[model samples]
Target: MDLPRAFTIRESSHRVCNPFTTEKLALLGRAISPSPGTRMLDLACGKGEMLCTWARDHGVSGTGVDISTVFLSAARARAAELGVADRIGFVHGGAAGYVADDPVGIAACVGATWIGSGMPGTVELLRRSLAPGGMMLVGEPYWRREPPDQATVEACHAERKDDFLPLPELLRRFGELGCDVVEMVLADQDSWDRYVAAQWLNIRRWLDANPDDELAAEMRAELAASPVKYATYEREYLGWGVFVLMNH
Candidate 1:
């Protein structure tokens, strides 16, 4: 099993594969300050950036699971590049029902919470692999401002007004799930740009190389419309963060 071709193509150049920039990611890592030798389990760990980096910076060890072979390959290369190959392992598999064999110091599902259906289920899934008092990291998006209309909501890539909560409500949801909001690092507009804008270039380069590809026209349309759509709707309306939670 693998990720859709469109996803891999759009984010082919991305290391983190989310709205988080390297700085924001590092900030989150430091905020948690995982002790050396801590064990982590990262689900839907795109390109394994967090795992590889933490293994390098904090001397932690982890396993990352993802459905994309392409991303898994990139993840392994990243582990080798950071000289942390021995500290991390990657598996090519679905993350929806996957749990670590051992209770971990940290369990994370970043950006891809749909793997467990939604926030509550995702938290439960992470908890299955979390040791007592260990941290659970969830990366998610919130509405920065309420969308004015259905068109705006659609533009922001939400099916309805409730697709994402505003920041305060998001935190409250964590409380509702019986977790304390321990720490967080948010994505700024610039970081959002780095994540979204870069996709256009990747799509453009791919279109140039594969003009006859079946998805080329679709990608071209997306490339043409994405910048304006992003600047108008997503950049201003969406806020993303990696939040650290501990069970209460």
Candidate 2:
């Protein structure tokens, strides 16, 4: 009834599960403009930051579902801190097969398409919880520019060969899912920095406090190598965004 242990590690490390900064996430949250009183569902809602913020600003009620108990607990505390404890609920369960209890005006699976096998399957998962005319939001990654070479793609954490499509092609894949892209908020370098670099500081502090923990070795190695690898590869080439969609 919890997300895998890897998720807990990532959260403890202050790392984003995906390359979305709080600002970029807020931008996507604002872009959709959920109707007043409309209900929303956030699948794979890591720490529930996006849902809590949206509930505070947009006058909507919702539930956030995640497999990570650690994140669910943090999300619950966050909702309380924001004085929206009753407005948003956090559930600790796998998002892969979960649907909203009620038809929602917006159903989102931000940066967790793998929950449904891939982007298209994730849209189908979201669609089940969406009311007619409701928006479905999917966050995904794409190349900022055509790869200069195979090495560049690999540097971005993608396979050296063709693993991801270009930006337009990625959107086209969504169209093939019977959805129309309604709105989108893309992440820039600044946002990416917040998402990635901030984690380095958090990881460093965690390492200091838990110097001899069994996981320290792995964390330390990742912390030591990630900045160099991310800056050299992902920072320059990979871009991420959340797209709002409606059934075509």
Candidate 2 structure quality by residue, lDDT tens digits, 63-150: 9888887887888888898898888998777899798878999999988888998787889999999999999989888888788988
* Candidate 2, poorest ten consecutive residues by summed lDDT: 6-15
Candidate 1 C-alpha lDDT tens digits along 1-248:
99889999999999889999988889888888999999999999989999999999999999999999999999999999999999899999999999999999999999989999888899999999999999999998899998899988888777898989999999999999999999988999999999999999999999999999999989999999999999999999989899999999
Judging by TM-score against the true structure, name the best candidate: 1
* Superposition error at 5 for model 2 (Å): 5.1
How close to the true structure is residue 203 of candidate 1, measured as C-alpha lDDT?
98
Per-candidate TM-scores read 0.98, 0.91
Ten-residue segment with the worst summed lDDT in candidate 1? 151-160
| True-structure lDDT of candidate 1 | 0.94
Q: Candidate 2, TM-score vs. the true structure?
A: 0.91
Q: How many pairs of residues in model 1 come into backbone collision?
A: 0
> Which residue pairs does candidate 2 place in steric collision?
3-67, 3-68
